[model samples]
Target chain A: MKEIRWHGRGGQGGFTAARLLGMAASLSPGYYVQAFPSFGPERRGAPVLGFTRIDTKPIHDHSKVYSCDYVVVLDESLLAVVDVFEGLKADGIMLINSARGGEAFTASGRQVYTIDATGIALAVLGQPVTSTPMFGAFVGATGLVDLPAALTAVDMTLPADSRAKNREVVEWAYNELRRKINA
Target chain B: MSNEAWEGRRAFISANDAVSYAVRLCRPEVIAAYPITPQTSVVEKLSEFIAGGGMDCQFINVESEHSAMAAVMGAAMMGCRTFTASSSQGLMYMCEMLHYVSGSRFPVVMMNANRTLAAPWNIYGDHRDSLAMRDAGWLQVYVENAQEALDTVLQAYRVAEDAAVRTPAMVCLDGFVLTHTYEIVNIPGQREVDAFLPPYAPGENVLDLANPRSLCISVAPEWQTEFRCQQQAAMEAAKGAIARADGDFAAAFGRRWGGMVEEYRCEDADYVLLGMGSVMGTTRLVVDKLRAEGLKAGLMKIRFFRPFPREEIAALGRRVKGIGVIDRDVSFGNAGALYTEAKAALYSAGGASPHTVNFIAGLSGRDITKEHIETMYRKVMNAAAGGAEREIQFAGLRWEEW
Candidate 1:
């Protein structure tokens, strides 16, 4: 069971990102998918959470994701307030939305992928839904889930009026991820 | 129960290993836990299981015990089977989260190694820790031995995961007793366990984004009562599940320890002792010795502490003329901890006919013995025969030789 924990503030589309991921994974045959939010009374701008479980076998647990194989931080500011890498497996990959790219952190011990998801989100969606571009970065860093399926998930989850912009964001992020990973 | 599989496999594994093997058999999709001994070893083994590959699972190591359970809560909210473990201060620390895990109707399996809460700084066995949190809505079971520990841990998942009882379960094994003891346990292969416990498919969860249901979300009092009624119903439903799980476990493992109350030579006994955890092993010998001497003494081992198994306990009370409860742990300011629960369980039945006596001993590994058990039996029988007058009795006190 591959559990993905999405780190983002309440309104930063953490739950939305998780839903998109689940929707994307569900498109494939032999895949069991789930998405959930941390049920709390905390409001917007407060650190909020969403989680996903993707596995070939049926998923039986609906708990928060701890030692995620992949960690995707949508907001750079969260790093100071949250220990995003707390339970990550030593060999796990992390994708962060920072303009400094992967160079911000020393990658000698672990793989760290940096994508300017904020820039991509603002340019395409004209809003700060950093999760869309960050999701692209996550796909780029780890080949565990499919990019096409993820974009398809985005299409399903986004409102029809905002669908074109979200799709463009996904495409742009995927291409950038591919280029960086290949280089 | 068998040596065929473990004949040459006497490896030095921690309580965590036993927990992991049991969890692996239960086949939970999401495994979440935070570090707190003797609970850390459990999560560590799970991490190893995930790292070694083969068991397709999502292993989540969260920042704290709070998040550890929160993670499982979120997963269980999505209608997935989830699990985590904690002990003593850690269990207490997760108090608020514990209420949420069960209140939400999420069947999560958690193991709490009963340990003492701090004061003068002790890290050993005691019941006060878990006892304090008894009001929290989780089905609790206390195991007597390592084998029982392994068995009960697995059963917890089955019981908690049942649709009729979709509630979280906490299986308590005495720290340093069952938690550290090494025994030849018949660890069931995955296939048999799968046959016994089917995959969890909840009726609904937080994952259905399109259908989007609000869970553990705020609600008005009327709706809250309906939810509480459902929770209560599930807890009441667990009694049958416990018995059924015990019987099925015995049938599968070739070891029979059925019934809500495991009676030991209680058929025609005049005096009986009752309690949970490993102390019952020593208590058994005392009952046997008294029975051999024609004293009509026996034991009523209450395995499932929560749900209290009141009817079964009352039945045991009805058979016996007097009863003695040997508690290995105590709750300060209160009477012998387990003793209080036992009396409450047997109170209305026969108006406490068994004349229950409470004996507190062996807190923090003070070493309880067959002799101690003998002293308890004698005291309880004396009380039954009008040799003592105290309604509640204390056995084996050295009195500081003052």
Candidate 2:
């Protein structure tokens, strides 16, 4: 089982990102996935969290994700406001939507990958909804799901008018992050 | 029923959306509801369906939950299939009409998003809302996930509108837990649902001008007891109707929920954890983990809380050494409702009863984790070994040291 936790604000599309990730993973024949938000009464800019769990077998544990293999932060500002790495596994990976390099973050014995997802979102989507691009960086950081599958999920979730640019941004993030990791 | 082919489709959607889709397939003639948290999406999606010409139904926008129930009752009495949904405060507001709907034997199917009642003002998932009105003479079923939420609504109408069991039914899903969670679900086609659940024939309860019959008239004290007795008999008849509906649904669609209670990994287990709603999903995982560790642990998920499944509880209790009842709602001064009911069921079985413990957890939407479930199972095992300390235990209460 691979569990991932997402951190963002109320209007930042954290919930959408989690659902999209689950939908993408579930495209595989044998994968079982779940996506849910930590629901609360909140307005825009308030801290929000969402979770996704993917597995080879049917997933039964419905409780909140305490220990997760991946943590995706949609807003780098949430790093100081909340404990983004609270329950991350020892060998887990953290993907941040930031312009800063991975060396800026100190996560002992864990890999940290930083990408300028907001920039890509602004360039491609004409708005700063970083969920799609962040998902792209996720696919790039961990080759857990196919890039084509992730793009297909993006197409399914977004409007027809926005699909072309959203797909372009996702593909750009995936290739850009993969190049950075290899470098 | 139309001879349309069964063309079920799969979708990744929330439980709320699933309920909306199910209700659409059932094709209720009338839908009246006031929006409430968690439950708001069910009606919201239904409204979208109506607006988009996906559903042909009268969607009544009522002023309050009370009015919502009253409107549905009127529509249902006129021999039209009626539907509504509410949660927490909205349910409490509609409490008065609930009894009238049941007493008149109007088969109004309602989707209740089970939420905690408020004093400190919380909007999280709990069974307090629906369970509080358990004695309103309505058939109640709690679902674990989105697919069940969809399938059960289809089954609920069948059980509710059965001539032998003319009663209202509340299909419950945990407010935020199941209502907001997204998962893959197989939605059966309208043709299959229509074939399984034929149109609602208001048979004897129709309020027509041609008949001019008096309903719910003033009854003398002597006959009131008989009226109540007949209602009780109808409820008793519902047990069979529910089972048959589940069987027929399984034959039509490819899924069945074991009718009243779902026993998981309990064939050779000595200790079983029992609960209802979404929490049971977590308990099942813990049971599997304990089984892997060689502990004789299992789970019994109560589906129909109104029927109580007394016979199934007693039968399982006879084999297990101990059973833990994990309830998300408290009965205040008494034990949790499920724990008390299970104990009474075992006591009436005319034999030695299993050692039972009550673990009250997840009130006001607090998270009940795997650790809490594991602790409850361990307590049951210890009690089975005669290490029992108390009858009722609060699973995740925080206390300051004295």
Candidate 3:
């Protein structure tokens, strides 16, 4: 079983990204996926958390993700305000959507990887909805799901007109992360 | 109910959306609802379905939850399959009509998004609202996930409209936990649902103009007792009806939640954790973790709050060395409601009393963590080893002065 937590402010599509990942993972045979938000009375721009869990067996745990294998931060600004790496496992990875290069933070031996997901989103989608691009980075960093599977998930989740651009951003972010990893 | 093979389409949706889809499949003739937090999405989706021509039903936009229940009651009395949904404050507002609906024997199927009651005014998931109405004479069933929420709604109508047990039913899912969580759910086909639950036939309770008879009228003291006794008898008969509905639904749709209570690895365990609603999912995970550590821990999910599953619970209490009852709601001055009821049931059955503890957790949407459940199991194990100090412990309370 693999659990991933997404940290983003409200209206930044954190829940949408988690749901897309779940929907994409569910397409694979023998995979059980769950996506949910830590719901509270949070208005726009307030910090929020969304969670996704994928497993070979049927997922039964409904509790919040206290210790997750990966953490995806949609906004790097939240790093100063929120403890985005609170419950990340020692061997887990943190994928942050930032334009900065070589910005690093490690907690309890956890690794932090920064990517220009917002830049990719603005270039591809003409906006800063970093969820899709960050999803691409997640796929690239974790390799838990395939690029085609993630694109198919975007196709199913987003509207028709938005799918093409979202797919472009996803591919761009994925290739960018792969290039960075190799470098 | 036919045993014919029927296939269902699988989709990823939230529990609230699942309820809307199930109501559409059931094809309720009248749907009267008032929007409330965590429950608004259900009627919103249903209204969308109605607007998109996906379902042909009367959608009544009532002013309040009380009016919503009254509208459904009126429609049900006029021989229409009626449905509605509500949450904490709304349900409490509709409390009077809930009793009236059950007493009039109008098998109205309602979905309640379980939320915490107010003094501090919380809009989070808890069982206080629905459990407060346990004596209102409605068949209440708490579901653990989106699939169970969908499947239970289909079975609720079957159980509610049973000729022998003409009573109302409340299908409850935790407000945000299950209602907002997205899951992959297999929705049964309309043909299968129709086969399983034929159109509700309002027998002897309808408002017939051809044969005029007073309904819900004032009864003398002597006849009032009989009326109450008959309602009690019908409630008792509903136990069998609920079991039959589950069995028939399983044969038709390939999913069954063991009638009133679902036991998970409880047969050979020295300690059992009992709970209801979505928290049972967490309890199961805790049980598995404990079992991995060689502790004989198990979980029992009480699906049906009404009818209380006395026999099953009593038998479980006798078998397990100790039982921990996790209640999201309190009974005030005694213990959690489930803990109190389980103790009463065990005592009445005159059996060996297993050391029982009540763990009140998740009040007002407080997240019950894995650590809290681990502590609960450790305490249960301690009690089983004859080291119990308290009868009730609040799982996540912050003691400022202690």
Candidate 2 wrongly placed segments (more than 4 Å): B1-7, B400-402
- Please state the CAPRI-style docking class of candidate 2: medium
lDDT of each: 0.74, 0.89, 0.88
lDDT of 2 by residue, B27-78 (tens): 9999999999989999998898888777889999999999999999999878
DockQ for every prediction shown? 0.01, 0.79, 0.75
Q: Which residue pairs in candidate 3 collide?
A: none
In order of DockQ, best first, we have: 2, 3, 1
Q: Per TM-score, what order, best first?
A: 2, 3, 1
Chain A vs. native, model 1, TM-score: 0.93
**Can you write out model 3's per-residue Cα lDDT over B1-402, one digit (the tens) per residue?**
121221365677899989988998898999999999889999999898888777789999989999999999999988999999999999999999999999889999999999999898978998999999999989999999999999999999999999998999999999998999988888787777889989999988888999987666778897888988988999889899989998998899888899899999988998988899998988888889899999999999999988778888888877888888999999898889998888888785566888888999999888888888988888888887889448888887798211
> Which tens-of-lDDT digit does each residue in A86-120 have in candidate 2?
89998999999999998888745578999999999
lDDT of 1 by residue, B1-402 (tens): 132442223222334467777887787889888877566667777787778774578998788888888988988887777888898888877899999988877888888887778875576676767777777888888777655677777788878877789888888877765565433344667777788788887887456878977888778886988988888788789999888887888887666565466888888888888887777866776676787888898888877766678787777776777888877666666777678877777876776576768887666555576767787787788888877656555555677210
lDDT of 3 at B49: 81
lDDT of 3 at B83: 97
Report iRMS (Å) of candidate 3. Answer: 1.0
| Candidate 3 structure quality by residue, lDDT tens digits, A1-183 | 999999998988999999989988987877888899878676788889999999998888878788899999999899889988888888888899887763456443577778988788788778889899989989988898999999999988899999999999888888888888888
Candidate 2 share of real interface contacts: 0.71
Per-model TM values vs. the true structure: 0.65, 0.97, 0.96
